[model samples]
Target chain A: AQRVTQVQPTGSSQWGEEVTLDCSYETSEYFYRIFWYRQLFSGEMVFLIYQPSFDTQNQRSGRYSVVFQKSFKSISLVISASQPEDSGTYFCALSELGTNTGKLTFGDGTVLTVKP
Target chain B: NAGVIQTPRHKVTGKGQEATLWCEPISGHSAVFWYRQTIVQGLEFLTYFRNQAPIDDSGMPKERFSAQMPNQSHSTLKIQSTQPQDSAVYLCASSLDITGSQNTLYFGAGTRLSVL
Candidate 1:
């Protein structure tokens, strides 16, 4: 079985503040991938980040970056310079490739609110 | 890209009713995914497909949940004997199939289901 965990259920920060969302996963396969998505109040699910394995290059999109740790089975998303528009739910995910199927398993999201 | 498209932005049903959610992946995408989201449970993976084939459905509830992708372009998730606990936002996502390790998912706005 594969599992992903996001410990923080809610987080809030003022404008220009920085925040971090935590994630952890358990899988038997050594190779893994991580994903981060944002869901707003309107119920739109948006793609934010995708990281493949411990050796895969870290992905950066403006203010978002994730650190991948293979030994501890953990990953974290760091959001810098938060804005009101960034208020939403953030999700962490894990996936592994196989001969049979490919599926991404997700964690309970962290709800983030950025105050203006 | 139009990204992933899910129909019936919202639906309301009574207990024991049947509900079907649809998803159309990006034009050339070969992988599709389904998920359920609620305030209490957050995001939960339901099932996914690769190249129009049922991949892993370990996340789906055995009693009432079923998913299918008969063609490469679209997939459907059907829930029979729906319960109040089934009320949540259903999200559909798609990705390329080069390798499960290189998967980058594009998501839809999601179908918000409310049970009365």
Candidate 2:
């Protein structure tokens, strides 16, 4: 079975500080993908970034990036120059490669508070 | 694009009542997914559909939960005999077809179900 784990249940960061939210996953499939999503206070789930297991180079999108440690089955989302608007509950999810269902097994999320 | 749309932003139901959550996927998207978010369980994969067909629902409770995608534009999650434990924010998301390898999901502002 594939599972994702977010050890920190809550985290806080001052505005302009770089914040790193950690996540680890267990998957039998050597080829898989990890995704980050932020659920805003208004209850919308927003896709952030994703990392495929095959890619050794981490992926980045604007101010959001990922530190993927494939060997440890761990990945962390790094948000640079954090802002209060970023406060939300962030989720890490895992999707196995080749599963036509496209099902994502999610981790217990980390609630983040970005204070300005 | 309007993004995915879920109706009834909030729902209140007593025990043993039935709750049906509706989702309208983004236009032209071929994959729709359902997830449940609670403080404890976090984000749980409830089910998914591909090409408007039921794909996988392994995470769904076999007893009171059922999901259907009758057409390309919409899907529904029905829960019978909702209990307090069933209370959660139900999220609906849709993505481009898996064949396209663009499985990133765009989500709706979920339906918050309060089971009393």
Candidate 3:
């Protein structure tokens, strides 16, 4: 069984500031991937970033980056220079490589509110 | 590419009625996944298919819930005798393939189901 946990239910940040959302997972599989997704107010979910368990390097895409700590089985998504449009629900998901189903176990999500 | 397409962005049903959701995966994608999301339960994996074949459905309810992917293009998830507790946003996602280290999933806007 794989489980993802997002300790912060809600987070608020000012424009141009950095916001970090934490995520932790528990899985028996040695190989898996962690993903970050943002659900806009329009109800569409967009992919933000992803980090593989095998890779020790932290992944960064635009203003979105991930702090992957394999030894602690934890990952964090950092949004730099946040803007008002960045306000949305951020979900952390896990996919186990052992299962061919490609099903993702997602966290409860952290709702972010960026104020101008 | 239009990404993954989910029809009936919103649906309302009476108790004991049936609700069916549809999804069209990416053209060359081989894996499709279904998930349900709510404010309380967050995101829950329902089922998935690989190359039009039923794979793991461990997350689906044993009764009253069913899913099928008859071809590589489309899939459907049907819930019989829908209950109020079943009300949630159903999300569909697709991936090129489940193998390899990086399996990034593309998601649709999702269908919001409401049972009264």
Top model number, DockQ: 3
Model 2 ranges with Cα > 4 A deviation: none
Best by TM-score: 3
- Interface RMSD for candidate 3 relative to the native interface: 1.1
TM-score of 3: 0.96
For model 1, how does the per-residue alpha-carbon lDDT over B5-107 read when each residue is reduced to its tens digit? 9999999999999999999999888889898888787777788888888877877999999999988888999999899999999999888763745478888
TM-score of each: 0.89, 0.95, 0.96
Q: Considering DockQ, which of the candidate structures 1 and 2 is the better prediction for this target?
A: 2
Candidate 3 lDDT score relative to the true structure:
0.92
Strongest candidate by lDDT:
3
Give the chain B TM-score achieved by candidate 3. Answer: 0.97
What residue pairs are clashing in model 3?
Answer: none
Candidate 1: what lDDT?
A: 0.85
Alpha carbon deviation, residue A95, candidate 1 (Å):
1.2
Residue-level error in angstroms, candidate 1, position B93? 1.0
For model 2, fnat equals 0.79
Give per-residue CA lDDT, model 1, range A17-96, as digits (tens): 98888999988876667889898888887888877775656677889998777778888898889899999999888777
Give, for candidate 2 chain A, the lowest lDDT window spanning 10 residues: A95-104
Local accuracy of candidate 3 as per-residue lDDT tens digits, B4-102 = 999999999999999999999989998899988888888888888988998888889999999999888899999999999999999999999887843
